[model samples]
Target: MDVDTAPKPAGPLLALRGISKRFTGVRALDRVDLDVHAGELHVLFGENGAGKSTLINVVSGTFPPDEGTFQFGGEDISHLTPQRARAIGISPVFQEFSLVPSLTVEENLFLGREITRGGVLHAREMRKRAAALIDELGFDLDPSQRVDDLSRAHQQMAEIAKALLGRVRLLILDEPTASLTERETGRLFELIARLKSQNIGLIYVSHRMREIRALADRVTVLRDGRHIRTLDAATSTDSELVELMTGRKIDLLFPTITHKPDKVMVDVENLTSADGSVRDVNFHARAGEITGIAGLVGCGKSELIRAIYGIEPIASGTVRIDGRPYEFPAPRRSLKRGMAYFPANRIVEGLALSRPIRENASMTALDLPAFAGFGVLRQAAERIAIKGVMEQLQLRPPNIERPAGMLSGGNRQKVMLGRALTRELSVFLFDEPSVGIDVGAKLEVYEFMKRLVGTGAAVIVVSSELPEVLALSNRLYVMHHGRIAAELSGTEKTEQNVLAGFFREHLLAEVA
Candidate 1:
């Protein structure tokens, strides 16, 4: 496809000069400057808490910048409201889903701008247009389907279709492919290419290095809430980009697992879920080893782990912890049996976002000897304990008093992991522990997991990213349709082997 060569404007299509934002005296964005061309796929790279999101928020008019000048299409748009920004051709697809669950795809697509005849909404016309738009995007989705029933990937597609319906001069995609499969991601890239051909400017934010290389024309790096540097994507390597974003060399993102596999810490036999999501699942997580669970979405991997963690009810199964048969009817029951679970939705399930960092970190270990005094909580001792965990995890802005909600994605993850580390546990269940975290923090997490294994703790990690599972696990299990379809150990655990197993199960089912 030929590059779109539209008439060049006098100034940048969008420019942010000396942007600064503050939250309770914290300099979230400090004198940041950025520029996006008219038809360029400009990538924004930053570590967690480096102020990428804050900068985008300021640009998109989600938050009024304390100090900055935002120029767009030859006008100063520094203080425009979010609605006004959207009206003037700036749309954003945030990390979180923004669609209303109860609304149908047609309603979500043309939500506020439904076709009107005689001052009445034309539902029939809106549906027809939405169906055509869905077809144009090559997505197999019904226009009348409720948004709540669609998969996350499909919801994301709906968001892209909605953005395309507007006069979108600049489309900002924040971690757009974070939850998509390789095939779905390819379709998204194709759509992005088509958008670029129409001279639609794009500001792409992602942690995945491969996506940036494939989609970006130029790159901007931010660190510690400041603009660090800008470079042409064609001239940058993944390592170089990592160095720029992190300000240090990242030799190994995944630490070497040295702990030998020992006794089985958690054993699940014939576990099944009520929804039939998981059936006859069997696995044993060994002490001092990282056992990984990998599968495509809806493959029963999450259900299998949740059942063991007591988050989901089990139909017929026996869970043994250290050779003791146990009935884990609740999370507290599992916790009391020396089991810790770091849920995938950390913000929602793992931490108390409204509470202070120290409280969240020390919640599980409050009754410990060090944190307890005369049958009461000792505030001083709790602070000391939480501080140690923060230092070990390298949580940025390491303030124990800050609300967990105010921390960046990586730091929030650290707090979640800190909760597990506070209590002495024999088994740890991690569900997508590094989902929204940055590269540097991911390395820190990898090292922390290795350290936990070194201390004779068993670890079970459930992840959708194949590289993360292959890089960290001592044993790998691939699940398909509620059962463990294949297990790879020692020299057999490779990406090719896992993919082959995944596809082979599909082929067998097709034949059957």
Candidate 2:
């Protein structure tokens, strides 16, 4: 699976000239030329469907380019086979990992190509080699530890180690730090620097400017399957990159909210998750207000909201809807108290991807008498209702019959939000609603949230992006270690305090 090839000179390690790829009637990539030198980090920037994935796939030998000249160390590698690409020292680590979770770190490192003697299994030899590689990469990982037990950061590192199992000269990382927390991203960046020191050429594909600014040496912009321009990382600005990718200047990413909050709609006291992930937390959300929850990953912000929505079992908690005590896991009991939750992942937790847009948007109304007559859905009524919501959200080519999965990132989110707004709900829970959506769509969503709160409905939003939360929310609750660490309102709400709240328990522990 791997070849021990000598390292070439520190010149143009990989060159792609006039690369073009097509899928059906769409041109995914068009005559894009990229040159990556040894010990350099080349970043690919684009919008969600901007051909970055296609280019990376071609380079990794998922398929050969239709028209292009690809050179590796000055040697022609055009139309290279996948196995040949790997053997010749090109390894790709995609956003979705290829590691088997049940296997150990060392076992996954040399998964397909194992160390064996006389056709017998050699665990010791494989473990030793894996440990050596882990040490060389300066990673703190036990080779024998199962990948299921590893954190997301460690799992990512394991995938990288697997890519470097052979003579790895060129490393391609596709959104390597997308799922990582702030600290995990920092660790991954440090590892990338170490690889750079070893003269490995890295091609990074990401839409996030923070990652690009931190890692990119030179950035190549792609728009509508065409190479716009390649700019020096040091000279490029976020606005410039946005302008190039979208062909428009977005002066504001988040819209300002002037609406005021009214009466308390949701009130919780001593809430705890059944799994003990979320500790005792007292929270409140008033009608006509957007209350934002801020925390790092695994800080129990999501669990707290889930418990409130009856999606998670509450161990010990008292929740009140309109000041009336509501029991956990409602609807089984005769309580009409409920909340609409928009999960972070629209495809997985939010939308039924294969279902029609009308059905997905009108799913909540299945029990309502307006759309559901005698439990059978009235197709005409559902279509008419959702089409109106789609127009309000400004969904492109608004056709309710289309599948939810076929839409772009922004449109898909709009479809999901439409489902929530179509129903009658007292509180709305949005977890990272603006993630992976375009600037125009993000603003549209924000405006919709303002209008929703304007209708006397309480909105509670959970987001990792601090600026959006600060800009849109009427109040901020920062969670730390399964509990509410700080409640910030008015001038007390700052990014520093909200982010610092993530480390509040750790800081307390350190001082003690």
Candidate 3:
């Protein structure tokens, strides 16, 4: 086969033909063809297992495709390595951080590509460059700070800053804004615009429709390891893109549930955590109702639930469950009292990723008679119960023995929700319930929340997505600087009202 050696004038900066990758028994990507031009913000739109990650990995040379012909500036470069990929200015910042936790931001940024004078490490020069990059990115972070000490958002900023340190021809950002605040996201968009102006190609992987609309010049939809469609992002409707990604139409993003509010199931008054992350919070979650706590990222919304669930120590507060005073709360005590809390950082706090699906799902309900009896493990009963719940959650593959780490973001989230189903619970506390998952998974989660409330169980959701919190909640509470700023219900739960609650202190100060 003769390959075209001549470069086409102003053609794609990077191109892949028949890119196919196989793992064990699975074909992760099949006969995929993609072209990314100079200065183009080409978005990779897909659901879980839709080949987005695999495609980017191939581009970054993390995974060599079994079958593919790659062209960079019209030259065939089939044999590509990670070093070669980086040498040619291809950089990827994945959802999972690649930074060393113990290392400072400056050290991590200059890790593999260290500056040296006569083979001696140029530490001062590296630090200066890192500081300049961080400042240019508008990141509120110290370059000397250890990666572990930085918050997830700050770590994300560090990742971006590192990527910008090199002569980047193509920058790949995988769910970059998943952990960022609105202001931070804006800063990132500005940086992206600057990159585009400099004629650097970018591949952005995101499930956010708003981001796709804002940054994407073109979007390529992938599904089940195959190329589905490549459409102009500016002209394509979200419905069209979603259908291509999922192979289905969604009638509603937020499913409606009948609210029949009863007595308060979980009540908190003047709650304050020992770490002072949450301060003087008050709220009530009634049975058969979805109480939403919404705010900007880093607001006390998540901390509020953490304090209530006994994950964080309560410095001062009162919690009443089912009209009974709950004191000295702990994990075991909270579980025994019929409360289930699904944390926002699912991988870290919720699911044990290395464990089997059955184990993770049954972890919360092991004390139940159906799972254990008289200190003896009932393996048969536990397996049956877990499988039943997995089926109800519509878990793909539905294999109880499969490692939780192997599942997609949506399925992994289902594993967490499955814990609540194995036992009877009066209250469900979900923190950032649907952050990284796709639309289809989000709907499934919403349905699960509805079913929980239908059974007269109270559901309290803490989320940064205003639309999700406002639409799902029967009553919405907005947090500002670790306190409840406003509570809206019925007609009062408009976006404007909720947004006002986000900056309540600033607004009040301006008015005064």
TM-score of each predicted structure versus truth: 0.92, 0.87, 0.95
Estimate, for each residue in 57-163, the C-alpha lDDT of model 2 and write its tens digit. 88899878999899987888866776788878899997657889999998888877887899998988888888888887766678899999987668878888889
TM-score of 2: 0.87
Cα lDDT tens digits for candidate 3, 138-177: 8899999999999999999988888777777889999999
For candidate 3, report its TM-score: 0.95
For every model shown, the clashing-pair count is 0, 0, 0
Q: RMSD of each candidate?
A: 2.9, 3.5, 3.6
* Model 3: residues with Cα > 4 Å off, grouped in runs: 1-9, 373-376, 509-512
Which of 1 and 3 is ahead in lDDT? Answer: 3
Model 3 residue 496 distance off true place after TM-score fit, in angstroms: 1.7
Tell me, by lDDT, which candidate is best. 3
State the weakest 10-residue window (summed lDDT) of model 3: 1-10
A best-first ranking of the candidates according to their lDDT comes to 3, 1, 2
